[model samples]
Target: MFDLLIQYEWMRNALYAGVIIGFISPLVGVYLVVRRLSLIADALAHVTLSGVAAGLLMQKEVAWFQGVNPLYTGMFFSLAGSMFVEKVRSLYRSYQELAIPILLSGGIGLGVVLISAADGFNVDIAGYLFGSILAVDEGELTLIAGIGILVVLFFLFFYKEMFALSFDEEHAVLTGISRKIINLLFMLVVALVIAASIRVVGILLVSALMTIPVAASLQFTNSFRQTLIWSVVFSQLAVFSGLFAAYYLDWASGGTIVLVSVAILLLILAVKRIVRIFRRNPVS
Candidate 1:
């Protein structure tokens, strides 16, 4: 695999794109878990799937769309889906969680129709669903890297506001943070992260990249800042290890990555339980 990295440009592209996603997904994921909107990532990823399917359909039927990239459409629809989520949540304030399932079902329904319209699922769409090393081309690497930078810059400038909002929206508002603008902008950021991530992790499993690292981190940390730092650590570890495994073992890249994440989460859970038992009994 290391030799492949030196020999193949595609290998480098996959590794680069995967690293960026490994970092950005969990970076935004902390806020998602803290805000209790982890499923929002799932909904947005599905909507992005609709967009990707649309792009693929157009690529087959439209001359203009043949020149266009699916990621662009995926990003647009994901952003639109984010706005719709906010709108629906506001409409049903008593049932904000309702937004998730509604968008998810709609996205799946739309994606299926578009995919079927394009003459059934092809290898191209399957790559988006499960991920592929060959799919992480130079263009995708650049696009995802650019979005990753934007996401990092957004948090750098708005970390305090995001932190405040995540911990307590009421307090953030009381502190005179413009809740409306921040909320909208935050949704866009999430949309961008989801769209960028789908290339390497696939739409079906991208939310796991966003969520699993944070879940593992929470097993070991109580501080918000520490949680963010550790989430990045665990995410990077999973991405590198999974990439290596995928390259050498001929496994599905996205599934391998997600399975590594799940293994880390379970290990953390077991360790925490053992620690609790040890603390209760005391070491002889």
Candidate 2:
């Protein structure tokens, strides 16, 4: 534990970012799952792949503009892709799901092109594909922390309106809150979180971090606030344990983290079932 962090700079960075991600992800994630927008989060994550690939391909140019850094391009393209998703959602309001497939497919297609062009397809792209607990750097860690703080601030400042919108869009609009603005803001925050998490969890398994905790919380919590708090607890356990396991076993961090979350969720469900059974057969 301490040995790994002491020996590897990357390990330290990954753990730091993972903690921030663990906290913020499930925070906004509860709302997404409640609103049935989990798929949208999944879509935005996939779209970020294009940004990462583009960053790698334009490493030279991006470095020239940003003074020799690849992450700038990655973050830039990610934020742009996120904004694009919002724009697409507005244009295809009647077919909201269409925006996901359109953006997801386009992103992968572009990513493949850029990756092949850069001869980076066969490289150690696992960090971008499945994530690595050893790939995180100081810059990426800072980005995740900054974004995490901003996300919490957004939720804190707009708690009332966000809560209303999450519960019922119609009621929120009826109450004079601009549902459009709130919804767009929610999506934007989701996009930012997903983008910041790409390096830590990758695109494929990012949605798991955003949903598994919510799934677990829903089984035991009826109130929205309770649900959010419990989800954060579950998320923290998943991310921290996964980071520890991935570091020791040298496995894919993204997959490991998500698997850990799922395991916890399953454990919670099992406990629920056993408790119910015991209650029914209390004579023993």
Candidate 3:
């Protein structure tokens, strides 16, 4: 399975993109999960889908002029959705979660309309919805790397502010940390990672990459730093294992990656339960 991956350019690109997306998703996702923004990732993914659909729709008329990349369209839509979420959250003030259903429905609705109108031929709409490991190429791999590096750099610079905002938004504001600015920044980062990852993880399963590791890591670690470390470790495990599985079985990379993460999460939960039982009464 491993040898087969090295022989093909598409496989190589898929693996590289998988690792990059693996790191990028949970890196920002950990904070989102901490801040109770878990569903935001899912909502943003649907928005990315809408973007792809919209982009593909444009391809019908301008197929001669513009060289369109679905990933770019997905990024544009995701970014717009991010901004929309931020604005709506601010507008509601008292009901932030309300932003989720509003944007989620809007994205899917637009995507459905676009897909139906275009007869679903503008792009491989399924790829945007479920991911396509085999579809990755050198150009897309480069874009993923660039976006990943930017996400890492952003996190490095604003670690403290993000920490404050995630742990306590009111406290962040009290400390003059500009919660609004940091939140918007966080949303943009989320958009960037989601768009970059859509090829490998797809819109439907990408949120799993963002949330699963964090969910598992919280079981064993109480410290935020430790949680981040474990989340990355689990993410890498899921990505590499799933990549290999997809290569060998011709399965969907996005589905495999998500399943791998879910399996690991379940394993961690089971072990934790067993450990608790053992600690209760260890037989001599």
Winning model by TM-score: 1
Over 195-270, each residue of candidate 1 has an lDDT whose tens digit, in order, gives: 9988778899988988999999998898999999999988888888777777778788888889989999999999
By TM-score, how accurate is candidate 3? 0.96
User: Residue 148 in model 1: shift from native, Å?
Assistant: 0.6
C-alpha RMSD for every candidate: 1.3, 2.2, 1.5
lDDT scores in order? 0.89, 0.79, 0.87
Model 3 stretches astray by more than 4 angstroms: 1-6, 64-66
lDDT of 2 by residue, 15-98 (tens): 888889888899889888887778877777767777777766666445554343444555566567667767887898787678
Runs of candidate 1 with Cα error greater than 4 angstroms are 121-123
Model 1 — which ten-residue stretch has the worst lDDT?
116-125
lDDT of 3 by residue, 108-208 (tens): 99989988887868356777778887789898999899999999999999999999888888888998998877788889999999999888888998799
Candidate 1 residue-wise lDDT at 34: 87
lDDT, candidate 2, residue 52? 74
